[model samples]
Target: MACNITKLPLFRSISSRSFASAANPKPIGGVCDYEVENSTVNGVLVTSAENNSPITRVSIVYRAGSRQESSDNQGVSHVLRLCAGLTTKSASQFMITRNIQQVGASLHCTLDRETISYTLEGTRKAVEQVLPFLSTVATEHTFRPWEVADIVGRLRLELATRPPQFRTVDLLHKAAYRTGLGNSLFIAKYNIGKIGPETLQHFVNCNLTADKATVVGLGVDHKELTYIVEKIKFPELAGQPINPSPYKGGEIRCDKGGDLAYVAIAGEGAGHNNMKEAAACAVLQKIFGTGSSVPYALDHGMLRSSIKVTDSFAISGLNANYADTGLVGAMFVAPSNVAGQITENVVDILKNGKVTDEWVSKGKNQLKAAVLLASENGKSVVRKLGQTGALTGSGISPNQYINLVESVSTQDVNNVLQKLGRNLSISSFGNLTCVPYLADLK
Candidate 1:
């Protein structure tokens, strides 16, 4: 969403329109600055911001997310995500862990359907002290067979503990795209132990390349970041060509019996390629409702406002953007007996919801707060900003994001709302006896 990039001395301005090859394959647009200056270094895209904060973070983001997985290598991304601290060519799992903890730094591996990011954060001097370890952990994965097998239990634990809402959204992606972006972030049970060391290595060799990655840093110098980035020996090419995954709507229902129903429905949304439209979708999500930001606070969201039943139910709008296409809609949780009605109400509102000037104004305010609050998590901001520069040719400053939000008018929001239910995808999980089918709804 947004990142705070405070000014630091000795930060020279470098002029750049966009990344060289960072967007080479599977490029998702939405090229705006993360309040960081962008530059291209040796074949890699580097984006960094200077700050006075003692904490510093640097992340190497590869385009190798779940979307990169093919039929033969499903769930490799999840396994790879868990394999972060495992043995690398340069260091053992024990040493990697020991060294990072020793420096009071944290190493994390996170992945979405689109990108997998490896981040190292600590005090500025501490990060500088172990900078090479970041590259070693990210690029030099050996994926020893024994080491890979040991983490299967961790995968199982993850799957078993996921909440219903997570499963519903994961299923929603499948119903929406059926492939590519539809791939699950979790490893399917069948693919559990089948993905061997070779499969892991093959996938990385083919999809994760230096040219297709972006380096992002916070509280760090551009020259220092660029210099280190050039030395990270990322995979040099000869991998699978990343393809654009378009949205194709459909429906899926998993009758996983339970007392409540988890349902998610969405329609085609604006992709990042169109800045105004994308920003509008962000605002539109807020307009419809994203529930209360205050924990344990009453939710008076627009989606909740229209519901007649007072039964325990939860609702929130969804807005997900990618390079080529996106999905916009809502998810609901309620007693199975009333699930259908709540879902119908959500769809009714989505398809016929009116976007007024006042609603749009409120949405802008909510969107601004959401972006700014998200930026508060320094690590998350760096991760989201990983590939922005590569996707779009250039960027705008922090103040300009407010300008972008302001640029979205009521008409633009309504334009997005009108697309709802056009090519809709509905995913329902849990006790689905009362959940309506896509055709059953008006």
Candidate 2:
């Protein structure tokens, strides 16, 4: 599965990478230069990105996600995501929504395999106006039984509407990790009966802790945000320590029976701990490219340029980093007739593709541009801080990220490629009858 750094709540439609090749790139809107303050007050980790803007976004980020789930509690994180705007212990759902709407604030819930974030964005006054409610929602939500049932129904509808890419990526995760990271983000239809309000509440109570959580403020006064966080009461619960899940490379195939076949070819990638290799993998992703800039455009990227596929097929490189492990790979979407050819071609590129100096320079610039553009949003800036702190126990600023990308050489790219060898984790969905198997690719 592709690591989707752009699929967040705020960055959905923002295609910042398109301008990577600009001869003279202009500074993006919002504050690029800012100060970050990290503190541990009463055991709660508080981080704030002070910047100039009328809008303030406060996010409560937790280290608990699907990776933290076990077989008994699979899909609890997804349930918790659905329960974000539900009733808190001190307030009703109606009052929470009415008050937020009254103040013209926006509330969003976003989660991945390793993290979950609940954020509120609006004017400073609107933020302060609803701080108490937001606090309750994050730290003291009362998962009502009826509300759980309602959200579960909505989740089912969402699952129905999800495209082939979602399923394909999900299957890819399953192939790569086998468990933990392999667990699907969307709750399985059968697992719905297994999860309930109590299950979600237990998961939250056991996994959500001050040490494993960070309260981040963006485009807001640090002093004010710190004060607000200080005044709020949080349960003094300790989180359970999670053992790292081993990466067992394998394959998962599903025949959804569609004209288009989806395939993911992956290998082991750098974990969050290996910052250098992770940075190198990021450069490698840019070197190979992820999908076409425009629809139905081939030769728009290294992967597309190298893979001998017709216009009816598409290929892109994908990399996902986790706290303890990662996945580096490519995905292909093509008519079933040529799915095997496209899959084999992609694997061939990963195994023996050459990395030139020109590719390295271009990839470095593209990675640098992506880093700068991603920092444009205050929310993203703070999210990075929380994620870094949660995953790696440190934060990477925009300048630091640019420097890291700048230091990536052709040798580093080649080294990363060598590390991600031919022992690939493969997944194929949608008319898998025409897709190639792992052994068949060889």
Candidate 3:
């Protein structure tokens, strides 16, 4: 649960009022500020907030990511994100890293399908000291030639050793959308090797821009943070807004090598703002994959599986909620021969939505219990808040989301299952021999 942001000591004694001023007034956007400041940094919306503590956490979020790239530039956002952590023209990465460490501060960046973020955390004093460096890395990193070579070498090694991690998701996306922004994760090995300094530079210049960025600083003084934000500038980018082309979901199949077959079945679900439908989908997924205590035979039996749970093969249900789209998926690693049987069994469980009141009640109770556990940590709280704000442009407390989950009825779960049955996308990775069994599911 350790996030990309750092923790510093200087924030032990600050008050929210430290940032209340005319120069940095409340934001004008609708429902944009949630214990934070919402402003436009070079035409990109930014959010900042203050806690009683003296620490300030700054995060720069952008809408650019793997989903924004063309087929030829599959991993461009990921490469660019790593490059953002490297040395800039005005300073060495080591010197800046050491300086921030001296003040008990840290910085990190993460790239996902829809967004990339840069986070900085430290005490007020350390944050103030490191803000300019953060700004420089954010807007002025040169992506030097030697550094690009070094990163590319490392990336190649990673791809070679860990191709499955990238390939699994990449293939899943391709399976879902045959063409458009979603189906372009696989860039040929030759193309990956050919990514040069110029390629990285062009990627950074074209994809990263103020128009698609959001800056969020939490637990800080708004006036001071606004002043710091105002000083940061980047060259204006001229182009049409990056609109992800529409996707029409379909099946995708591929073969690699392994004794067991790995399968992922997904379907379109509600977005973050569709609270009711989203909650229903969550309950539906839990009923199908949630652990035994629910009185569901399938979940109880799966929990009782004699197969030794390897650290890598822990089975779980996944619900990924995006701004515009969401995915509800279940993954299982089973013997190659039984892979088809498992998929069919799972699909049958989803189609035959038979949940008693006890099962529904238990699922709700389980979800509520987990939320209570997550609230004890400051980092989890901050992350949950940030993610909700980023996705929905609104804030919902943990209790609120739990309430929604608890309110989902058996009828709701059945409705979601019926909806899912109509639209399904499945992906299998392993030996080609296992693929025949999986392909028979449709």
Candidate 4:
């Protein structure tokens, strides 16, 4: 449900919905109808937040991410992201860059496992002058063979420079879901330059349509965004489907044989529909610990056993929520000699330990603070706005965000923790001599 919502207004019914909609037909003049407003303009999804800040961010978010790729079109998303701002059907790369930079507006692209965004950022007036570029870069792609070939080097550079931890997490997804959500964010080494123009076009035709797209704005008026979205007349196709990502917990190890080891162990968690459970899983991650809040100081809150290692070891709870399902557990970096001991100990605590009220309270506070901080930051706020709107169909306000954190209870936290580690998915990189296998850990 990306943006084809019709009939019902998509904006959250915050205050008196009937009164607000009737009294305030405009987007910004007095009191906000809602902190975040969600609506549909001519069958296209629009989500936005109005603020007094000078900076404005507008993104055309499409549900076509790496997960949207098919077996034949694997790694097409990676190629597609690099192809952004290239010679689109409407404008050349030089024209797009020069116009955006002339107005001090920045046009950029970002991708995650589930979505891709082409965003424009600058002052309101400046952004308005260059807003057309955003839509052009996002929706219109010429994908000339030569231009597409130029990005091959960039793709190689990205994969070659990835850190060990990143590689480990990539493998972890492969072990967890096996496909769909498990698809690698980076292109496969063998497939470089293999994803040609035809495949990229095909992938977009299937998944980058209006039914799978969301128009998101921050510090910009909703009406202004609505007008822009309506004018663009986004492309749409009916009945697009994706491979399901079901949790099939297992082990994936990358035996790189380094002195240091990177490990991520996880189990099934909540999904997008289970908001409360997702919040509870977040709390459980916090209670187990999210690393040290203080710079240079190690976290002594959760995974307390890691503290006694005497050698350097970093451990933080992992919680990820996706459209269908999620994964939750811990990820750590430690000396290869001690990786097995630390892994077993962390597993023991997550599966057998009982969380106290004090830890739960602390987790709530930390989680709330994080939410507030993200809500306030200009860059993070818009990204969150775009991501949530694109994925959930409705956006969340800062207040609603904090309230979600506050609503989780001690029982909820404990219940979520108790369900983890049932069938662990483990991914690690480094010396295999000492690091234990999933069979060994189980």
Going through the candidates in order, what is the number of backbone clashes in each?
2, 0, 3, 0
Model 3 Cα RMSD, 1 decimal: 6.5
- Checking candidate 4 for backbone clashes, the offending pairs are none
Shift of residue 186 alpha carbon in model 4, Å: 0.7
Report the lDDT of model 2 for residue 392: 75
**2 or 4: which has the higher TM-score?**
4
TM-score, every prediction: 0.90, 0.90, 0.78, 0.91
Tens-digit per-residue lDDT, 16-92, candidate 1: 31122122212121222345778887677888765444577888887778888889888999988888878888777
lDDT of 2 by residue, 253-357 (tens): 988886888998888888888888888888888887865446766446688777666556767778888887788878878898888888888888888877899
Judged by lDDT relative to the true structure, which candidate is superior, 3 or 4?
4
For candidate 1, what is the TM-score? 0.90
Model 3: per-residue Cα lDDT over 341-397, one tens digit each: 566756555445466676677656766776766654434545555565565654465
Q: Please list the residue runs of candidate 4 whose C-alpha ends up more than 4 Å from where it truly belongs after superposition.
A: 1-34, 305-307
* Candidates' C-alpha lDDT: 0.77, 0.75, 0.60, 0.77
**Which digits, one per residue and each the tens of the lDDT, describe model 4 over residues 1-442?**
1111001011111232111122222332222224899998766679988755667778888877888777887899888888888888777778876777777778778888888888777766667667777777777777899999998888888888888878888888999988898899888989998999998888888888888888988777787678668767567665268668789988887788769999898889997778899999988888778877899876876885444677778888888888878888888899988888888887777677778788899999999887776666766776777777777888788788778989999998888777875777888887756778788764
Worst 10 residues of 2 by lDDT: 2-11
Superposed Cα deviation of residue 437, candidate 4 (Å):
1.0
